[model samples]
Target: MTGTATLCTVTAPLTLFAAELGMDEGRIGLLSGIMPFFQALGILSLPVVLRFGSRSVATTALTMRYVFLGLFLIVPFFAARPDAVFGVLMAAMLGFAVCRSLAEAAISPWSQEFMPRSVRGRITGRMALAYVPVALGVSWAIQAWLDGRTGLDRFVPVFAVGIVIGIAGALMLLGLRGGRAADSNAPRRRSLTEPLRDRNFVIYLFASALQSIVFVSISLFLILFFRDRLGMSSGALVLLVALIPVGAAAGNVTAGWFVDRYGTRAIRTALQAGQIGLLLALPLLEPDVPAAGALVPLAFFLFGFLFQAGIAVGTVYMLNVIPPASKEEYTALHYSMDGLAGGLATFAAGFLLAWIGAGEVSVLGVDLGKYEVLFLVAAGLTVISALAYSRLHEEGALSVRDFVGHFTTGNPMKALWGINRYASRTSEDRRRDLAFQFGGVGSLLAKEELIAALRDPSFDVRHEAIRALGHISAHPAVLNALETVLEYDGLVELRYAALGSLGRLKATSCAPRIAQFMEDPNPLLRARAARSLGEIGDLSSLPRIRTMLHDDPDLDCRLAATSALGKLKDRASMPGLVDLYLEQASDRTNRVAEPRSKVVLLAITKIFRCEEEFSHQWRREEVQSGLAMPQILLQLAGRVRTGAPGASAKLRELTSDYNAEDTAATLAALAELLPALHQSRHRDSDLAVDVLNEVRTAAEPHPALLVAMAAILNRIFAA
Candidate 1:
């Protein structure tokens, strides 16, 4: 249906059609202004939308929009005067606007509510991929058809086809599952003033109003600027127009992924800044110059891309910030706001263009035309909008600087590079490009290319290839490749990566090969091998690991060995682990010794399942004074007990450095738990109560004690 709509009403044809009907710039602007005003009126139909559901409202409205569009296309044939033709077109446009506005108002809330939050951006992005090609083809075809025909003869068949196609599109909507009534309650009736009251929304409202005022001329005058100012032929103009949809499609697809990954605020703000940059470049584009063909299309493509991308991301952001109950109201209010601003802006632009009367004016030695003035104003308004957007907060949002850095360095560029190798001077460079480009978790689509790269002679190529394959480890080809690389690859780093990947994937079949690397000369490789063995849960390698734990001179190797012993539940290694801990525990003078001591103690706790006893051991040793062991123990205890209920809240209280006396008091109380739990097979209720009392007595109780205290009480209550 959207394809059909594109066929009937690509903006170029409508603007051209108005010109063919002898409409002046002011009349065209007035015609363009009619739709937004009707759209604003359409918002008042909220009660109607609520009475019937969104799907129903959208279907009905979309059907009516096409109906009027079909009528508008045909009505011109019967009109004798250009005024008669303009009047009928205006009425058709008004009808179309009413339908379009209702559809727009309901669709946002309906779609947002229907889709799960986790996959909405992904699904929307994928849908955009489909939307772009269809739109580009349809728009290209429509323009090509219009450019081929003389006069207004092109309208009849084009709009007729559109009506048929649009009806089919409307039918497809019947299958869509819109509202999940159970998940959300129906919205209550509220005054229209509610949305206007929000500070953020109000700020955004002003920004949007400014932008609407700025862009009112663009939709009305851009085609004229190209045809009249640039002297572009209709065929060439169609091609230029096609670039807009092409850029828009690409933008929507990419915007979905970024909006989902980075959060909405970053995407919205960056795209706004992007538009500012594009606007700044507009004056530099002298399309009338003999060599300006590429520049012309490039300008349209980038502006279309950034503008559409910003719209897509901004829509998602609005959906997120608005609550479920008020989504309909907020969306309607936004449309109305745009309509009011657009109408006024359109009239003002028309008046300004009329006053300027098609001649160039010099302002500060630069040639200023009405189009240039409008674009510059739009750019200025966009700056304000971007500033207003900066105040928005969303979880997981990147700052503008971080967003730019990530885009320049991340997978978006990788995808772009895959399409065109950006200045690769060597085969090795190309291979490296393919490696990072296709190395992500979802890069299985590039499996064959990645597999081929694995055979490349470049070590960097092979290393990155191995790492990329590891990311998609669940793929059978990738898994087999990693296993082969680990066993037969000549590069040690590649084999080491494969070993770690296999460990992360828990490839128990690779255990024997990993065990061989346990004695590798490279200490990092040996440590990783031991860690993999533990992760694979292969107890057969326990003795070899214990030997490493006892004899490995390398700190990392010994630490990895102790970690393996702990993971394997090897209680026999507990004495060695405890010895390792105690040796480092009293070395208060060595900063490095304290962390390793904690790791050793943690290993003991992991093996014995006696975290309380271990926590106390470190805490009591600190009572000797001027040692950091107590703080380290508190951190370790906090980590070890993270699974307990309210554990996070407890850690916050305990770890805060605001009150040193309270922190020490809470730690002192918590230190009593290990002995109490170890002494009785069953928990001693009196001892639990005493510990709780001690914690409660502190001026500000530490959260760590609250957690330990809860564990003691639960054990006591269970007994």
Candidate 2:
């Protein structure tokens, strides 16, 4: 599946690159459209391929694809006339498409065997990052070589090189040893529609197919629009085309990380925001201006990034909702849907281009070219697709932590709640439930009913009620009910649920009671409390929160405390915050190591206004405690000076007594901290001069750090 998908993606750009060789857009569309037809035919052969064992079938199909691609390169060299060229190109596309389709079908089933169904979406999404970069690089290099050349001669060598790469890629597949076929004793189903009968799978297929239509249309037409109407050169066009892949890569990685850490909701929300931004930005880009030309790629990159990430994340999430035994069939159905959608989109784009007259259209006082209007329509459809996809509730309705905890413990309750209570339910039901329970249900429900739901013997109902309470933000009665649960609930899950619910409700009224959980021996409870405190945005908890930053035994708890303290914007906690920051910076504990610590440091720098005052106080205290070393103190002093708004005199004072080692280390730390501090209304006067002096005297000055420092100073000075 991967190889075939890679081939199809790789070929799209090659066709686009060939279009630059004077092939009309209509012919390019036809050539691009033909491959999917063969691909669809190949997909129908999956039963035979799977019967042969996926690994063997995949390898053989990929090998044949490379051979056909090699043959394709030779066609241009041997064909004497344009008619022959067209015939050969079409034939090559058909053959290549067949091999690709077979490969896709074979691989899709095979991938399910190797990866956990829960994370299949992320795996597929991340895989695109790998394939896209390679595709972009190869396509760009081919176009670069073909620059200033005319005729099929240049394309022959370019495609010949692709053939070589294709061969290498095929050989790489040999490492995947296919497992033996399933036992002959297994029941054989004869119905062709058996797989599509799975309701969840059908919904997933529809969502995936609709999304593909928008994706394929945008991917195929954008390059031509940018080149013709926008007047983008070959080099610029390559870069623009590259953005979709690059953005896709970035979005995929981010989506995976976020889905794992925060859950599917975060990915969904982010995907919506990103897609909307990309959609709105496309028509605004002034293609004729060189400066504006950059937006074409920038927009596509962000669009591809968000859309692909969403697809990848959503796919895995949907897979998680379905039974594992059905994965192969479902995946096959997905690809089949993709082929159908791809065919329809190609045919539609070709017709739309011709119907729209290949020129500008005036809509709402804005002149948009025919292609641009197509993109606008595609973007609008994409938004609608996203909304529809978001509505499908296969996975059970659960908050991020609940979902993670449930999955980690191998519990199905979370999944069930998502499916029954959240996802599959109507929007009216969701909104009504959310508003009733979380919004003001405490006021509406009889006290007995509220208590009964809370104390329900059925764990699933209890869990759902608890989740519903989280959604009730404005209801004081719900807040009170959650508080009662927090005080009495025996189950750890129940207690965590109450805390999480209160937090989401932003029940600041419960802040005092919630603070007691920070001292709970259970690390999970403590972590949840800290997160709730941050969400509540109550400053009263800052002292205890700051203490937890250093004293909590669990790293998760400590990090949560750090996060909470930052959100509270409590500058009085700065001394403790700084201590935690330095410890995190210097500690070798892998448990506490994460990039979020930088965010903590950055947050502290923003809230604290008087670094010089804090440093002077620290120096005095350290001297009095008999724990201060002049060298360490001097470094600390330098950091303070570096952070000051206009501290030339202070920096000069510190520089006079600076030990070489202390100065070097302090300089490095300051180099890191300065920009973060500089951005906080602290850059002015001769602070830049002092930093320059410190940079010059450092034993091992980092060139990159120095450059960053210079850029910071320049921005400050410019402002």
Which structure among the candidates has the greatest TM-score? Answer: 1
Which residue runs does candidate 1 get wrong by more than 4 Å?
A: 74-80, 179-187, 209-216, 287-290, 407-719
lDDT of 1 at 49: 67
Please provide, for model 1 over 173-254, each residue's C-alpha lDDT reduced to its tens digit, 9 standing for 90 to 100. 7789874322235447645677877877777666665555555556567677777777776656755776776777678777
- Model 2 C-alpha lDDT per residue in residues 120-165, reported as the tens digit of each score: 5557657877767665765466557656576656656656655666
lDDT of each: 0.67, 0.60
| Count of backbone collisions within predicted model 2 | 11
Give residue 21's error in model 2 in angstroms.
Answer: 4.6
**Model 2 worst lDDT run, 10 consecutive residues:** 439-448
Candidate 1, residue 125: how far the Cα is off, in Å:
2.9
